[model samples]
Target: MKIKDYAILISVIMIIVMMVIPLPPLLLDILIMINLSIALTIILVAMNTREALEFSIFPTLLLLTTLFRLGLNVSTTRSILTNQTGGEVIETFGSFVVGGSAIIGILVFLILVIIQFLVITKGSERVAEVAARFTLDSMPGKQMSIDADLGAGMISDMEAKKRREKVSQEADFYGAMDGASKFVKGDAIAGIIITIINIIGGLLIGILVHGMPFGEAAQLFTLLSIGDGLVSQIPALLISTAAGIVVTRAVSEGNLGTDITKQLFAYPKLLYIVAGTLSLIAVFTPINPMLVLPVAGLVAYGGFTMQRNLNKEEKLEKEASAKSPELDSIKSPESVIDLLHVDAIEFEFGYGLIPIADKNQGGDLLDRVIMIRRQCAIELGIVVPVIRIRDNIQLQPNEYVIKIKGNRVASGEIMLNHYLAMSPGIDDDSIEGIPTIEPAFGMPALWVNEDMKEEAEMSGYAIIDPPSVVSTHLTEVIKRHAHELIGRQEVRALIENIRETSPAVVEELIPNQLAIGDVQKVLMKLLKEKVSIRNLLAILETLADFSSQTKDPDLLTEYVRQALSRQITLQYAQPNQALQVITAGASLEKKFAESVHRTEQGTYLSIDPETSQLIFQSISEQASQMQRTGIQPILLASPGTRMYMRQFIERFSPELPVLSYNELEPEIEIQSVGIVNISSGAVNMS
Candidate 1:
């Protein structure tokens, strides 16, 4: 018998035995801790070791459990002492003293609970970080990939990066001094006010509930009754449960605040069951010998079920979905880039000094602009060129003082001609008599803005679309024509012309500095700008899998380039032949199975065909050794691998059935994969 079979069998028996045994109090406590820890670990494993597992609630729950036990002890002792002292004992304390003290204790506890809850809620993220750090500490030589999930896009990398940057900024000397001043002047006052409120509330509750005079008939508040007992506790019970649910939901959403309210509304039955069970235990368990187990079980089951439904699965899925966008950013298969084709390179920097010809301004820095244009080349499924631009300066209307910079090969007016010439089927004749030419091209002209016909005469530039149409409509018409009639080279030339003169950079930087949300927008724009060859291949693989399969390499390449040009999120990698080769091992196993099914005339164990060959191979050598010793042989196989072992042993005799691992003598054992710590020792039942 294989060792794995014995391990499984023994583990099952031990669990059954443990469940049935009446454990001592110390052992019961140990078991409780172990069981809860195991349950937590199982939930963490299912959630794939993500950040949510590090949330503060786990430790809070453990602390609550300890406090609940302490509360139980306090309740028991109070009950016993009060019973002994009797009604006369309170009378001896002059009524006022006992009432005031009871109120004080209750008020104190309430204040503590509220303060702790607030502190936890406020510092929950920090707590999660600490939890993650503690969890990793136990595993030596193992480091978690800190940004693995962010890199995968469950959370935005750009968002995390921005947060870190903000922290760094705040850590600077000036920022630190400003923060400390604010904290002392502002937060210190707020905290002091809260503390004062807590003390006043505690004192008021103490005086009203205890020290204040009351008749004998009104003395019922001191004892357990509907108003002062479980009924009063119900609100807190409901609130805490709702808080748990809300916190789980919000944490999953990467938000602050608990989603407890939602869970309370969702599972009315669970709250009822838990409340009823807890009430029953508090009221009756102390007096009953046999009710303990059932109550404990009910409470445990309620907690388990509540967490399972509301806290774990849905939360994990939300966290995982958050990562999809990062994955989407991979370059697609249709992007192509050819660096050898050289042309004008447009560099962008600063803004406003340059009036954008229209709203389609290329507002970005030179480095960023280059990267995005590169990405565009990869997306378009065509060869991209190394563009160089010069004499690129933005000017106000009617300004003829063009400060053309390095390598000023052409004037801004000349650049405008190259741009207009990129339309599919137009030429110099098409724009010959436009009115507002020179000023439209940011040049000195008296007739500019009077009409295209007037400007064309003044500056030699013309409006391809009629003046009655909106500028956007005209640009779209021009773009459509350029896309269809002009080839990539002409389009590249046109883009270069625009890059040399168009104010694209100013368009990008303004919005990002305005709000927190714009950070994501800016980041996405950056990612889409730069298309790399490696990224394009990754996108193609996904597309090929989900959409249509492609065989034409040229078409594939061109499509990738176009996609990159469009700035869509995608990733691609070249086809992997080696991976295909590795997958062939499955086919080899199939061949082996065929060979066994057709076997003939072999004396083997009377086993199923599936396991016959496995058993034959395993025991053949042992059988041969036994024959030389003039003795029979017995072979054991582990439970899960039994089929394989049975087939291996079949080469010997058909009469012998393979023994299972557990059925063998205690001293006999064999190592098995995916199992731990099996030994040739006596099996100990729970």
Candidate 2:
């Protein structure tokens, strides 16, 4: 068995042995100190750890420590009554009161008991209970957030798994603490009871059994009893304080001591007020000047020192800024060359929304941009440029614009303080707010306050915050413009990245069969149709096989599509379900085949504009009909017409999925949803 497996059992058995055996005074003293050491170590660990989950073993350890301390108390009680001694440890602690008043030792013991039982234990127990309940209640939301990040491609599978495990561990830790808190509370009560028992039992044993005088018996046993209690209670007090800190601490970068000092010494203005109050007390109150004057002077001096440090820090910051290379370069903006280069993507927010755009003001737009870039890379297999975000004085307060290549592509307005509530199309409009349009999908929505969120949810409305609305719009915008972002540079980077894993594929395909530009065009063609180019090895291999036959990018793209049939079909068709599609009849297919025009540049559809309009109109009508019935709009045609039709219809319906019959796997069933038939009454094919 592993050491971890047996360690807990060994500790428990030792606790049992401690309660039963008659320990020697020397060994008893060692055990007592060890108990105090363990308790102190636990408290220190609690103070140092960054988060509660980092100390997940705390609850089980709490149980063991409490039992160990109790066992030591029992053995000491046994010694006190049995031989009128509890080792030198108890006698040493009792000496504190023996020099003067007996009442003083008893009062101090009682105070410690009251503080641990009534103050620390009670408060910590309540905190543990509340924390456990909240953690359990929020489990669903936390779990959902992890799954959403995974689904959005914002996080990889390994990251999502780790986050989910952390959520479960947090819930379990807090729940155990809720129950473990009872152990400390019981230990405190047991301490009080044990002290009383030791006192009464010690007196009886000393006077009746040992034949001592009543006064001497009382004095000797009372001191020993107080000392025994002190030893146990002090450790218990430390353990209880540690419990409080764990349940109450927020996740922070530093240890408890650093956090305390940093927060307390943050504001010198507050210190100035404190110093003034202390000076008033020193002058007006009956307090002695010796105690108050020097302390007040120290506080006044601390305030002055804090103010001086603050000024020095500000001065150093300005000096650092002045000395920065960027600042020096900005002295001649016209001469500097940075203004010539433009960002691939940029967001310009108006001045009123500055609070939400600044990272210091709780804005996580920068973080969201990173997630957006990751998601885009995962879904479309393209690297989106790092988006530049800045405040624009030219736009309205609530308005924002998204620019692609320094040209505006999309823009929207949002209310920073209110949430966007979109109807779920399941309930009547009972909740009232400012009606608006959702920018991502052009759906009708409402701007609702926080108070209305629950009601809106109850009414089946999708409530979204300003950041989310902007993120959704930005995601769609980037997805639509993904093709424009991928240039020869990005393609080269992809090839270099792939070379690390599959060098043979890159070596065989690039410069030998096709140049990097030729491969780039094929990748762009795939991206334009929303195909993920993440499978670059497969794409390169397919290009190598077919590039020898055709130097055309469009034909190479068709061959690549055939190679990616599984990826393409799985995305459009559900598993074990037939693929739904709109196909062209034989006559219409023949007409498109004959009209296909080829040049040294590329293939084109040479049909008259009038004939092309009629064919597209009929296809569009059929696609809309299928969409109304909730079927996805997919058109399958013969390989010859498929390429031409897609090239032909792309101008009108770029979002439509056009696939050749050969591009589908043989295993997938085909369900013909409609057939495109040009109206004979409207036009005739010559």
Candidate 3:
């Protein structure tokens, strides 16, 4: 083992040795000084530590110090009873510090024991008990919070592990302290008992064994015994005080000294009151003005200095506040760009529904927002901005709005203390309340009272609380606007992230074959169609493969989708189930391909309005049939027609998802649910 590792063990062994073996006065004196040094060092460390956990080893150190003191007491007792002297250490304390008065020396020792045992040690033990109990009781909750933070992406795995270890250590330290505090208490009792026994035993040994005169023997041993007790008790009191400091300290930015100065002198007016009180006592009381007047004058001077300093700080703060705006304007002129910047997504609630966002009222909308951004980044390749939330007093108490770029995309009102009740997406159940529509999907719902929540759930209706309703709506709004949130900055950040893993792909595609704006357009096109860009390297690699073929974003997006076909197929197709879809008949596909117009602007379908209307009407009929059969309404079209068909479908059934044939995986089951044939002028469902 290392020398430092054995140092504590060796010291502890020496303490045990001291209890059994007699020592010379010179050696005893050296050991006595060491005891005082350790005690002073511990107390100083306690004062300097910002919190108890910082000095987690203190409880074990307390036990060691107490044992060392008791052992010294035993050695001193032996020396005093066998010979007329305990040690140079005890004699020096008795003669020099206590002024050769045995009574005064004894009284000092007793006072130290009383303070250590009754006041400091007693309180320390009780606090340790409570702190240990509470710490253990709270361990599970603290662990869960750490897990929650780790899950929420607020902290990393290593950080969470460190925090959990620290919590376990805190619980261990406090529990050990609860028992270690007893060591100090027992030491105090032992000091008192040992002192009394030595006094009685010394008187008998001196007069009876040595045949010394009674007066001489009593005087000699009494001084030595009291001094010995004083030496041991002094160190005991120091450690007990240290124990108290460690147990009682709270976590703070600074140690005990800084906290005291800042908090005690926080109010200059309080000091002024003290100065006035001191002046009144000096003037009215029949005390010596010589003693009282100078003290009062000092107090008044201190108060005046504090008041002057406080005024200086206040004046400086005011001047800084007054000058900040002009200084900022001069350094950086006002620009419309700064004022025009807006939150990509914002959630605002009225005063009545403020509880849904307020943390103190058990709301978790803020945390939910963090989770939403994370989910979107995983599900759709987008770094959604931190959604800003605010209370809008002008809004109806129960109303909230979800806005994108300062435009309200959707809004709804909810009952403050009610739950949203709906049948499991079925229109059969007729449970009634205040009629409302689910904001996200526009499903029919009712606002039912809290007491009716259990009945609704029991009756097979889904029940959602007010906060969840708002959060669900917010989630959908961000998803729909995910494409808009990602711009050049977000795209650059994504590319930078990709560069870390796939630098060659990013280097090959940008600036050589295409610019960053073109790549951004491709990714935006994918996002607009609800494609996830989380696998950015794959997307970039696919873009790199095809950028030389075409600069058109719509075609590049199609190529990216062809590469991500497996993901797209699984997204709509259930596991091992037929991928039911409505197909654009050959005649319709032929017509769309024939009408496709190419220009420098972009490739677009140039079919006349009448032909476009006819195609959409057929697609709508097929979509209604798909919805009725509980099939996911997906349309299969040629890669050339898919982009234009998406635009066509959006004008009518905005939520209908469309994909090209290349976007489907080779192995997926293709069950044609219907056909869209404008020649037939009507759609048919299988």
TM-score per candidate, in order? Answer: 0.23, 0.61, 0.66
Clashes of each: 111, 0, 1
- Model 3 residue 149 lDDT? 72
Candidate 2: list runs displaced more than 4 Å.
Answer: 1-9, 48-56, 96-104, 130-176, 203-220, 251-253, 269-287, 322-527, 530-686
lDDT of each: 0.34, 0.87, 0.84
Give a tens-digit lDDT track for model 2, residues 1-686: 89987986897898999899989889899999999999999999999988898889999999999889889988998988998899998898898544534577789899999999999999999999999999999999999888666654467556888899999999999999999999999999999999889888888999889999998888888888899999999999999999999999888989889898778898977877887888888889999878887887888899899889998999999989878877667677755666789888999999988877688999978778778887887888887777889999999999999999999999999999899998876655678788889998788899998888889988888899999999999999998888889899989978888898899988998889999999989988898888889888899999999999998998899999989999998889998788889887777887888787778777777878788788878888888888778788998888877778888889899889999888888899998877775545253322
Query: Rank order by TM-score, top first?
Result: 3, 2, 1
Task: Sort all candidates by lDDT, best to worst.
Answer: 2, 3, 1
Pairwise TM-score winner, candidates 1 and 2: 2
Tens digit of per-residue lDDT, candidate 3, span 364-428? 88888777876787788676776788999989888898899999899999997788998776543
Better of 2 and 3 by TM-score: 3
**In candidate 3, which residue ranges exceed 4 Å CA deviation?**
1-3, 20-22, 81-84, 131-173, 201-216, 268-286, 333-344, 348-385, 391-439, 442-469, 479-624, 633-686
Local distance difference test, candidate 2: 0.87
In terms of lDDT, which candidate is strongest?
A: 2
Tens-digit lDDT track for model 1 on 370-418? 3433344444332222333222245422222211122222222212222
